[model samples]
Target: MISGVTLLDYRERYSTKVYFQKRFFTVYIPFLFWSIFILFYSLILGRISISDLSFASIIDGIINSKFLSFYWFFMPLFAIYLSIPIISLIPKNKRKTIFEYIIGVFFVFNSFLPLVFNLLKIPYNSSLYIPVLGGYIIWIFIGYYLDRFDLNNKSRKIIYILGILGLLLQIVGTWFFSYQNGYVDQMFKGYNNLPSWLYSSAFFLFIKENYHKLNFKGILSKLISLCEKETFGVYLIQYYLMEFFILVLHFDPYSISYRLGASVLIFFLSVFIVKILHKIPIIQKLC
Candidate 1:
């Protein structure tokens, strides 16, 4: 028979392992859910409103916007807005060839963008993609460390504090110092400019604090999981739907309310659209 002390130790070890597994999903689920909503809108621009039709025109638009941007400052997320979710899919321990990793990072960073800038007449911030994707990748590495390594409380606290502080600095740099010209004001430069580091830090901590309390089983849980899965589909296509609203409603998308309205309304509608598309065989690939 097992000794009492050994049995208790085994039980504690098992509990800790179980908790780590749950925490991993907790961080991922919320990030993925929001990424879907943003991705839908990005795709709409690429699919429906593309007018420039050339890579040079897109680059020209970026330069032109910086100099003589006559349009009101409006920031809509690009599909790379889903970076946080995308990185979650990168397996932590999977090693890559040097060339493959470089290509992987490059491809991940530019997934929905090169097409958008090349095709769409719209010109937004150009360089903001770096920190958005970079910060997310960094967070994934951080998440891996927190989960995979044996870190003492002191080490965790130091990392947590430094991460928070660095993020604050990045936010300050984006808002008051660097980053401008209407590229998703959520990034390093724009109105309410904040760095990806700041945003990701807040997101990471928010899930860490709330994951346990969230019911991961039940009807609502399933609903949220569905939402998370739909993020990319919703993100890529929602903006196309919004373009419909833009043309028909004559809504001044420059206004904050309009953007938020676009984001909110597009989310559920895309969710419904995704569900319907899933039922069809041929269109499932598009979704």
Candidate 2:
């Protein structure tokens, strides 16, 4: 949804060159800086040995985002940013049809087909390949589509119902499979799955539709604005804060209260740290 807003903003206001430059400075540079910082932190914590630190290894880490596992999201996000020039070329008149077709193709091959194959115990041989329509890219198109078009009351109602069903399927199916298998199962929890897509889309639509109704004032508004501004930095540094909580503070992972408390504490701490970092001229841009 954020990416969709970005794409919309870019297409409506900025040139491709300008967008690319802004993305480079704001996103790419910060990603690079944070990846390296994580790498150094890992080394200090003995998660990685000094002997493993070489120029080639560092380059590999940056490219693969090995410093933090979830940081792999950056590669796809970067690719999406790079493809913006081509994606933005879709003429306004045909965008609705084209985007719908693209999203449909993606849903079938990437989500539905895989689920079908897995259920039927059929090995996928890659017989029919639709390379252009798959993965996180689908979300970008979905985001753009949702942003560009408005759904009627009937359509919104149907989508909301399906989304609720999707959410139930995700939660119940995972629990059932896990219980049967005597282990945790993540089969239904992937973002690329049908359930995830439906749930996410519905949630995005709900927020978009109702955003104006939510009016915050005074300290609450200021705090929300501050957190929003520092979100990127918080995301970048959150892993370390989590590690600090778990390893240093010895927070009980199994305790629900501890988990909830830790989450709130980590978020505020990360925001505070990022806010402080922003005050330093040299470090501000990197974050």
Candidate 3:
């Protein structure tokens, strides 16, 4: 969604330096602040001992997002942001064809072929290496393509149905494999996989198609805008709030009821905290 939204507002004439500067302050600064904050919070909660702390370890934690598992998202997100200027440099007339070819390559090699190899129990070792064309960057192009083009009703319906099937595969496949292994299987649960791509694409299209039909007005719209502004800040801090619930409050997140309640509470609490932080001039920029 971030990539799609960014593309919506992007212009080739925009200054790369200014764009990077804004992202550095708005995204990276908050990431750094929360990384350190979470590290200290974990320490205070006895999640890690004093001996585990070192300058090197701290740097590694921030760089690799080892402090909080969810923080790993920032690294790829920043990478994508860094690539946007280059992405924007693609010739306007040739962008559609180039994006299509690249997306197809990503689908075949990075997603489809890997799944096929894994399912067949094949020892997959590809000599063909295209690091820049692989990983979550595909999503960036996918988002751009989907936003730029309109799908007909038939196409949308097919995509929606496939998305439903993809979701079912993730749920059922994971449960089956996990039951056999006696542990949760993460194989079916990553964004880079086909199932996730289908599910996410369908969801994105659904929102894009129907958004105009929905009524958002007055205070409701303002509230929605406020929430949108706080989203990144909330994401940066929400993991620690969840950890506090699990570790300090002993909330069992595995329980459906507890999960729902905790999620709502954490969301509102994080929003409130971010809202308060936004009042402070310097602190607001960091978060």
Model 2, 1-287: lDDT tens digits are 57866774476787878888999999999998888888888888799998978999999999997778868888988887777678778788898899889888877877878777876879765655368854477788888777779989998998899889989988998899899999888778788888898899889888778765654445556768879989888888888888777789888777886677888888999999999999999999877
The candidate scoring highest on lDDT is: 2
TM per prediction: 0.45, 0.92, 0.91
CA RMSD of all predictions: 14.6, 2.0, 2.2
**Residue-level lDDT tens digits of model 1 in 58-109:** 4454334321232112112212223334433445345233324543454444
Which has the higher lDDT value, candidate number 1 or candidate number 3?
3
Please, what are the lDDT tens digits per residue for candidate 3 over residues 1-287? 55745753466446777787888888888888989988888799898887988999999989997888888988888878877778887886787899889888877777777777877889667755357775588888878887877778898899899889989989999999899999998767889887898889888887777775653555556767769878888898788788789989999989886678889889989999999989999888877
Give the runs in model 1 whose Cα sits over 4 Å from its true position.
1-140, 147-152, 155-172, 178-195, 214-220
Give the C-alpha lDDT of model 3: 0.81
lDDT for each of the candidates? 0.47, 0.82, 0.81
Q: Sort by lDDT, best first: what order?
A: 2, 3, 1
- Candidate 2: which stretches are off by over 4 Å? 8-11, 125-129, 216-223
Model 2, 166: alpha-carbon shift in Å? 1.1
Q: After superposition, how far is residue 26 of candidate 3 from its true place, in Å?
A: 0.7
Candidate 2's displacement at residue 133, Å, is 1.9
